[model samples]
Each structure stands twice: as structure tokens, then as C-alpha cells.
Target: MTAISLPSAMEFIWLEADLLDSHDYAAWLALWTATGHYIIPTERDAEDYAAVLNVVYDDQEMREARVKRLQSGLSMSASPAARTVRTVSRFRAMDGAAGVFVVRCAQHIVEYKYDRTRMLAADVLFWLVPAASGISLQRKVVTLINGDDALHGIGYLL
Candidate 1:
């Protein structure tokens, strides 16, 4: 099998991060495959995918519903939305089976509201499949350093 180029993988990471940081939720959601899974793990061992809470696990239709809710102006929790900035670094490619290319990285996400600022550090595993348009996400597993702590949930994508 031909190896996926580093530049190609990095480019995908850059584009994905840009879409997420810019809060282009619809465009971002469109990039996932039909069976894609979004998981945020409570522990560091995200490779043990069995131990995680899935924040977004949707087919195309369910993903569309989520986007619709965000756009309807009915999500009151997002009225005074928090500002978010996510920085992803230290990307490394990994070999895997199942026609998926895996990229591991570290992420620092900072979110700020009027009176509160929350910082999150996580190890991110991005499982991607090459698609006609670009890379389609198969799974995005984020293992937060402090996943079990009490924190307010941001209404939008993280």
C-alpha cells in the first residue's frame, strides 16, 4: 500500500482546525463520513475507545438535525456564545488497518465567556479516509486531560 504523504495529512489537519476554530459548524460537519464517530474520552487511553462518551455520533440525517438546531436561533444556551481558539500541534502519522490513516496530535483549546475562561488540553486521534473531495473523518477521539472535572458545556462544537 502507498503511504499517505505527510504534507497531505498536515494539510488536512490545518483545514480541519481552521474550520473548527472559525465555528463553521455546517461546513465542518459535512466533512465526516456517514459512520463517523466523535468521542471525548474521560481517560488518557483513547486507544481503548470503549471507555469514552460520544458527544456526536450521527449519520448524515442526525448531523443535519444538529446543524439545524444551531442555526435556528432557538439554542438559548448559545445566546452569548463563548469565544473559542484551538491550537493543534505535534502531529504524527500512524499505520493502521481498515483503510484508515491515523494522525495523533495534541490540542489546546481555550474558551472564554464574559467572566470565565476555560482551558483544555487533550490528546487527539483523528482517523481519516481518503475521499473524492478530501479527507473524510472516520473517527475523532479526544482524550481530555481533565475530562472528569466539573465544567460548563459549550453549546457548539469543541
Candidate 2:
């Protein structure tokens, strides 16, 4: 696997945010590896998600199921289909082993739906691996800035 350059990593990050904002679920799903995990914790200090409850803990299969639900329009929470815009910044690439890297960044995401708009600030950590096409996500950990705070329906992807 070729080492992922800084520019390439940044491009990958941008592409992901764009795809999500565009509601291109199929395209975004293709960016993950077979064993990729997407997690959102309720506790910022929690280490074991299995032992402690998490807001979102999605494996590939779970992710696919979620996409299906959103696309099928059966989810009542997604009735109007929320619109989202995300800005990714403060990206720093950290070495992971020989070829892999861990990217840390801050994401400011705004979601609009149901005649309401909500803003969420989050810190994201992505485990990136080189793939045949480009980079694939091994894991994505999103820590909400207000993790411990009471949140309304967060039905949309953040």
C-alpha cells in the first residue's frame, strides 16, 4: 500500500463531507472497508462502548441497514429528510504503524429539518487505510462536544 500523502488525505476528508452533505449515502458507504466501524459516544470519557451505551455504534451491516431505512423513507424521523452542511478543519495526520494514519479533525455540522435547525460541534477521529481506489475508513469515532448534554432527536447522520 502506498503511503497516503497529506494532500490526498485532505482531499479524502473533503470528499466524505461533501458526499454526506449531498445525501449521497451509497457513495459515502463505499468509502469504508469491510470491517469499518462508525461510533458516536454518549460519554466523552468512555472507553468500552460495548460495556457502556453509545449513541451510535455501527458496523458495515448496521450502516447498510441505516442507509436502507433512510432511502426507503419508512423512518418517521426522516420523514422530511434533514439537510446537512459540514465543515471539517484542524486536520492533523498522525502516524499509525507503517502505512496507516489516524486523522484528527473538528467538524461543525448544521442540520435543518422539521422547521428547525440544529448545530453540532464534534471532534472526529478517522482511522484511514490505503485501498485499491484510494483511502478506506477502518474506523470513525465522533465525539460530540455536548456528549453529556440532553439532545433532541438526532435522527440524521452527523
lDDT of every predicted structure (CA atoms):
0.75, 0.87
Reference-based lDDT, residue 146, model 2: 92
Q: Runs in model 1 with CA error above 4 Å?
A: 1-3, 43-61
Encode model 2's per-residue lDDT on 1-158: one tens digit a residue.
Answer: 67787788889989999988887899999999998889999989887776788888999999999888887878888766788889999999876766677899999999888788889999998889999998998988899999878987866677
- Give the per-residue lDDT of model 1 (tens digit) for 1-158: 34456677788877888887777877888789988877765555445555455544455677678777766788886655677788988999887777789999998988888788888888888888888876788888776777766556666665
Candidate 2 has what TM-score? 0.93
- Model 2, backbone clash pairs (residues 3+ apart or across chains), number: 0
For all the candidates, what are their Cα RMSDs to the real structure?
2.7, 1.4
Give the candidate number with the greatest lDDT.
Answer: 2
Overall local distance difference test of candidate 2: 0.87
